[model samples]
Every structure is written in structure tokens, then in C-alpha cells.
Target chain A: MATPQLKQTPLNAAHRRMGARMVDFGGWDMPVQYPYGTIEEHLRTRTHAGLFDVSHMGEIDVRGRDAIAFVNRVTSNDASKLVDGQAQYSALTTPEGTVVDDLLVYRFAEDHLLLVVNASTTPKDWEWIRSHKQDEAVELKNMSAEYCQLALQGPDALRILQTLTDLPLSEIKYYHFREGAVDGVPSIVSRTGYTGEDGFEVYAAAERAEQLWDRILEAGRFGETDGVMPCGLAARNTLRLESAMALYGNDIDETTTLLEANLGWICKLGKGVFIGREALARQKEEGVKRRLVGFEVTERGIARDHQDVLVNGERVGQVTSGSPAPYLKKNIGLAYVPVEFAGAGQEIQIDVRGRAVGAQIVPTPFYKREKKQSAGSHQPSAKTQ
Target chain B: MANVPEDLHYSKDHEWLRVEGDVAVIGITDYAQNSLGDVVYVELPKPGEKFEAHESFGSVESVKAVSEIFTPVSGEVVEVNESLSDEPEKVNEDPYGAGWMIRMRMNNPGEVDSLLSSVEYEEFTSAETE
Candidate 1:
């Protein structure tokens, strides 16, 4: 089959100038790593700050009097509970309780909210939302191409980003956002991250992406090594994996439900009549049969995605996402198994090709950010549901 | 730019062969290591295993991707680099020496002549990067 032309972010030229290895990520030409490599970028993001071009992520604007009602009906979370400037991780679920796409709902006003969906799922999500619109006053616009999202993550994220934006970043609690001028560019500054690190995600107009990117890079480029690393998709994956956050295609998809993927915290079944609520409520009452669990490879091999998960040499399930956790310094992964074998200490095997490798079930969020006393208390930011 | 050692025989697949009598010292080339980034894990065939020329005998996995290590010539594996199991990054640090994957008794040493030389391998890799 012939390949289609890959989409490019506004910062494509900048990435090329930095000598980053570009790859096709969900049909978009994205940087997978720079000359420093994924491991170094991953480590630096944990210790220092890391800049990421996240412009390919889809954005949708939900507006009108029925916006809150419309969002609540389609998403698994209770949007009514969210106040202006707050955000929550939620999912669009099918009637069968399976995920359509996990997204972030940022409430800007009583009748306006911004929905950030995965890059690959933009068109589908738009179609799904438009088709599901019942004679409601809510108007949904796919503004994915109009915005450029950049994440400045890690321990020094605030210190770095604060230089460019006059917004009191530390005052912005986790998962909450504020609209402000960042380096003269209007942007939505949100305290959220996928790396399990306390960080900020800034969204600005797509055309001004290069300017925003350059400003952030210049603001944080301290000395020879004290600066933020310009990270890429490869490091992003490893960082999220170490945090045990679910990747849409790998950990959660149409075949999986919120409960099975361990995202039940975001599934508000009692919020009244949302799609998939009935099925999820039933599952809750009946109890989930299979669940996603984190495991560490006890043996020599690294268990990769799509590898089979076994119990006593019998195939039970497959690894959803697996790799060497750079921060944890061990090979870890998430896999589904029968509820009886889901608890920590349960021995399981991962079929790395034909080899049965020893592994033990462990509690997830494989890595967590340390709470620094000087910064006071900040909410532990949640990832995509 | 990759460091190409002229003393080694290079395979198009990027394996470097150093012939020591009948036993061939084989590992991936400097070009391969530079492209692979950090080596996180190295999976190798046990000693005494036999492999055909151009057949993948093992794999080297980095943080980004996985690459198979193919043999330039058919051989019986006499010794495997067990140290790589613990220190796979040695491949990135020193591809020619400590990262040597295996010592093999080749069925035919003449197959080494069929592989690329230092100049040809460097030319081919430069074209690949372009």
C-alpha cells in the first residue's frame, strides 16, 4: 500500500534543526528522539525539565447553553461537578462500556469547555460527538488544527516555564488551568502532565507555535547541561509507562472498558444517564472478571507489547504495554489477567516470543513524583482515563 | 557519523566480523551502535547453537526500537557474550571490543570476502542516513 503524506507540526523545522529522529506517529511526522537519545531524555525529564511538541493532539471546543449537559451525556465523567478553570481526565465510552477515546475536558465557563483528544482519534471523536448530538444547543467545533500544545515537564518545569509566562504557575493547582499571555502569546496554561511529574501544559495558537517553542527553549536553556531537554515521542512513552499511565492504543482501546483498564476513578456511573453507564454499573455490581495489573520481569527478558501473558504455561491474556521503565530501572508492563491472579505477589509469565519469562504482579503508578516541602502541597495530577 | 574500523569485515546488516583463525569474532558495527542509541537489552543464542548465513541469531533492543543481529556467515556459536546480559550499553560504549556478541567457528571463511569492506560499508551507511 502507498503511504499517505504525513502531517507536520508547526515546530517541524525546529526539530529538524535540532537533529531529532523523526517518525510517523499516528500519521503525523513527529520527533521520536533528539541526538541525546530516549534514555537520556527520559532521565533528564525526571530530574530537570523537558520540552515536548504536542501540537498533533486534537482539540475540540464545546460551547452553548447545553454544553455541560452534552459533555456529561457523552463522557464517562460528571462534568457538572467541574468548575471553571478545572480539568478532569475522562473517556468517551460506547454503549457497551468500551472506550471510544480517552480525553481531557477543560471547563472554561458554564457553557464552554475544551476537549483535548488523542492526535489519531480527532476525526473519529469529532464524528462521534457530532453524531451523538441530540437537538441540544451545544455546538462542537474541531479546533485541532488551530492549536499547538507544548508540555514542559519534570522537576524544574515550573522554574523553567515561569520565566516565559507571567502567570503565577505555582498558584495554578494540578489539573487546573488559567488563560494568560505567555511570552506575548495568548495561551492556556494548565498544571498537568503524563510523566507523573509536576509540570505544565501550555496551549497557544498553532501559527505562533514556533515562537512559543523558541521562547520556552531560550528561557530554559541554562548553561551547558542545566537546561531543559527537548524531548520527543519515545521519551514521552517511556515516561508515561513508568508512571503506569495508559496509552490509548496499547493499554486502552475499543476492546477495553474503563474498569478493566483501572480507570474506574474517572468513571462516574451515578452522574445520571451517560453512555456506557448502565453496562459499567452492571459490571461494578457483578464485579470485574479481569483487570489490568502491573508486573515486573523477574527473569532476563524484556516483555514487549502484544506478547502473551500466561498462567502455568497456559495463555490467559496479552501484554497491553511493556518496556524497560527507565526511572524504575527495571522491565515493567501492564497486562490483563483473571481477577484471582490480579493481586500483587501473583506469579505470571510473559511469552516473549516462545520464551516464558518469569514476572510478578505489582502495584502500579510504577513511578511517582516526590512532594517537595518548599513548593507546599500540590495535587497529584491524574493522567488520561 | 559512525566510526568505521578498517580492520573489520562488515556485513550489509551491520555486523562486524573479525576472523581469528577458524573462530570469527562477531558484533554489530559502530554504525549500528550509533543508530541504535542506548542498548537496554541484548538477547543472544546460547553457546553451541548453529546459525545460517544472514539468519538472525539474536536481537538488540534499545529504548526506541529493536534490531536483529544477523550472521554474516554460517557458524557454530562457540561462545556468547554473557556480559551483555547485564551491560547491554557496552555495545553503545565500545561496539568492537566488550560488545563483541559471539565467537563462532564458521562453516566457510570465504563468506567473509563476500561482505562489505570498511569503505563500502561506510558509503552504504552514509547513503542510508541520507
Candidate 2:
């Protein structure tokens, strides 16, 4: 069979001009790295700033009178608790309490919400959301193709962005957002990202994305800014892995439950009924069958996806995502194991390419958190006096 | 793309064999390494294992995918690269040198004639690219 053709992002030309090695990422033709490679990009993002073009991810806008109420019934998180300019990480689950997609719920206002979903699961999520839209007052519009998104991540992300807008970025607390102009292009800058770093995600008109990308790259050339580079899917994956952030298809899928996936925090039992709430409540009461846990290989060999998890030579569960961590310099993976062996520090073995490698369960977020500047110190004029 | 070394014989599967007396040093060609970016792990055949020509020996895994390694010539595996277990990225860095996968005693020295020459392997990979 012929290799699949890749889908182009808005910044394809820019990536090519920068001499990036492009690859097929979930159908999107994205740069896996510049000439410097994934290791450099990974380190750059952790230490300084890195720019990423994540325009391929789908964005849907939920608006109208019953928008908040409608969304509250579809997702695991209590959407009603989100104030304007606040964003909450959530999951959309099936009636059986299995995940449909993990998403970001950005409450722009009381009646307007922006849902950012996984690229591969976009169509299915849209269909599911629309199918459940029974209220005439709710309007669901897919604006994924209309906007382009960029992530500026690292410790210096705030400094680099502050140079462009007079808006006080320090005041935009983590998981909060504001609408403003970047180089005259109206954009929404959100203080949230998947890399577990201090960063901001900028959403702007697709036509203006190239201009914005170039501007940020140019600004990143300043002093103490050698760390800024264009990151591709390779570095993004490793960064997210080190942060213990779950990938949708690998870590949580349509059959994976919020409880089993270790995302119980997103499922609220006290709130009014939502889809999958009863099943999740029952799981909570009776205890879950399997749990997703992080593990580090104690022996040589890299554990990979779909490998079997063995406890005392008995096949118990399976590995979902595994890699030799670039930062930790050890083979680490996420696996679904029996609830008994899921606790941190539990010993286990992962069958890697037919050989069992010794491993021990560890705490989540394998990477350490970097200190961030307080939002009150840099509040934007529109949000403050 | 780097030129395939003229001193080595190539397999259609992209393995390179450098015959030194009765022993052959085996490694993947530059074309293979470039195609399989950033190799993270290499599973080598056990030392003393015997295999026929074109037989599966082990596998090379990258972050994106995994591919089987094929024996270029029927031989008894005499040694495997132990250094690769700790650092597989060497295959991406210097595929022909320290990244060499195995050393084997060739079953028949005349089998080298059936393998491609460096120039032939270059033309073969170039054609495949187009």
C-alpha cells in the first residue's frame, strides 16, 4: 500500500522555509523538527521558549442561550463553575463512562464557550456533541478551519509575548484567557498549554497565522533567547510524556473510562446529571477494574505501545504509551494494570520486544513544574483598572 | 544523502555487509537510517544464533515506528553491538561505524556476488525515492 499523504497546516510553507523535517502527524504534514532535531527542541522548550503551530487541532464554538447548560450535560467537568476568560480541562465520555475525547473547555462568556479537541477525534466529537444538542437555544459551530492556533511555551514565554502586546501577561493566570490584538491581528491568548510549562496559546484568523508565526520567531531572536525554536510533533510528544499528560488515542480511548484513566478529578458526582455520570458514579462506588499508572523501566530496553504488562510473570495489563524519556534519560511508559499493582512504587515488568524489562510504578508528571509569574502583577487593562 | 561506502556489499533490505576474512560486519546503510529517523532502540540477534540469508534477525525501533532487521547473508551471529542497548541514537549518528549491528561468520563467501555494489545500492535507493 502507498504511504498516506499528509495534510498541510497553515504554516507549512514557513516550516519548509525554516528547513524543518516534516512528517505525517495524524494526517497533518507537520514539522517533526528543524535541522537541530527533537532533543534540542525538547530542551529549548523546557529551558526557554518554543513556538508550535497546532492549527490542525479542531476548535468548536458553543453559543446561545442554553449553551452553558447544554455543555454541562455533555462533559465530565462542571462547566457552570467556569467564569469568563477561564478554561477547564475536561473529557467527553460515552454513556458507559468511557472517554470520547479529552478536551479544553474555554468559557469565553456565560453563553459562549470554545471547545478545543483532539485532531484525530474532532469529527467524532463534533458528531457526538451535535447529536446531543436537543435544545433549540443552543448553537454548535465548528470553527476549526477558520482559525489557526500557536503555542508559545517555556519559562520566557511571557517575556517574549509581553514585548508584542501592552497587555499585562503576568495577570493572565494559568488557565485564563483574554482577547487582544497581536501585531494588529485580533487574537485570543490563553495561559494554558499541554507541555506543562509557563506558556500561552494564541488563536487568530487563519490568514494572519503566517504573519504571526514569523513575528514570534523574529522576536525570539533577542538576547537570552537562543532557546526559542520551532517545535514539531516529536518534541511535543516527548514534552507531554515527561509532563505525564495523556495522549488521547494512546492513553485514553473510546473504551477507556475517566476512572480507569486516572482522570477522576474531571468527573463530578455532585453536579446535576450528565451523560455517563451514573456509570462513573457506580464505578466510583464499586471501585474500578484497572487503572492507568506510570512506570520506569528498571532494566534495559525501551517499552513501546501495546506491549504486555506482567506482574510476577503473569500477564495483567498492557502498555499504552512508552518511550526512553529524553529528559529523565530512562525508559518510562504509561500502562493499564490491575488496580492492585497500580500504586506508585509497585514493581512490575513490561514485555519489550519479547523480553521482559523490570519496571516500578511512579508518580505522575515525571517532569518538575517551573515557577510562573503571578497574574495580578500584569493584569491587562481590559480586565483591570 | 550520503554515498554508500564502496567497500561494502548491500542487501535489498538496506543492510550493509563488510566482509573481513570469514567474518562479516553488518549495519544498516545510510539510506535506511535517514528514512528511520532517530532510532531509539535496536533489538539484536543473540550471539551464536544462525540464520539464513534474507531471514529476520532482529528489529530497529524509532520513535515513530519499528522495522525488522534482515540478515544480508546466511551466517552464525558471532557478536552483537552491546553499546546500542544503552544508546540506540548512535545508529542515527554514525550508522556505518559504531552503530554496526552484528558480526557474523558467513556461510558462503561467494554470496557477496549476489549483493549490490555501493553504486548499485545508491541507484536502487534513489529509484525507490522517486
**Largest lDDT belongs to which candidate?**
1
Instruction: Give the runs in model 1 whose Cα sits over 4 Å from its true position.
Output: A373-385
User: Per-residue CA lDDT of candidate 2, range A329-381, in tens?
Assistant: 77788899888888888999998767888999988777866464453222110
Q: What is the DockQ of each candidate?
A: 0.82, 0.45
Candidate-wise lDDT, in order? 0.90, 0.86
Off by over 4 Å in 2: A1-6, A222-225, A372-385
Clashing residue pairs in candidate 2 are A170-A375, A171-A375, A171-A378
TM-score (chain B only), all candidates: 0.98, 0.98
Candidate 1 residue pairs in backbone clash:
none
A1-385 per-residue lDDT for model 1 (tens digits): 9989999999999999999989999999999999888998999999998999999999999999999999999999889999999998899999989999999999999999999999999989999999999988988899999999999998889988888878998898888899999999999999887887888999999999999888888888833487888999989999998888888989889999888887888888889999999999999899888898889999988999999999998999889888988878899998988888888899999998788999999887778778773333323222222
Candidate 2 per-residue lDDT over residues B1-130, each given as its tens digit? 7659989999989999999999999999888987777788888888989999999999997765688999888989999999998888889899899999999999998998899999999899999977
TM-score of structure candidate 2: 0.93
Model 1: per-residue Cα lDDT at residue B79: 97
Judge candidate 2 at residue B74 and give its lDDT: 91
Q: For residues B17-81, what per-residue lDDT tens digits would candidate 1 score against the true structure?
A: 99999999999988898888889999999989999999999999997677999999998999999
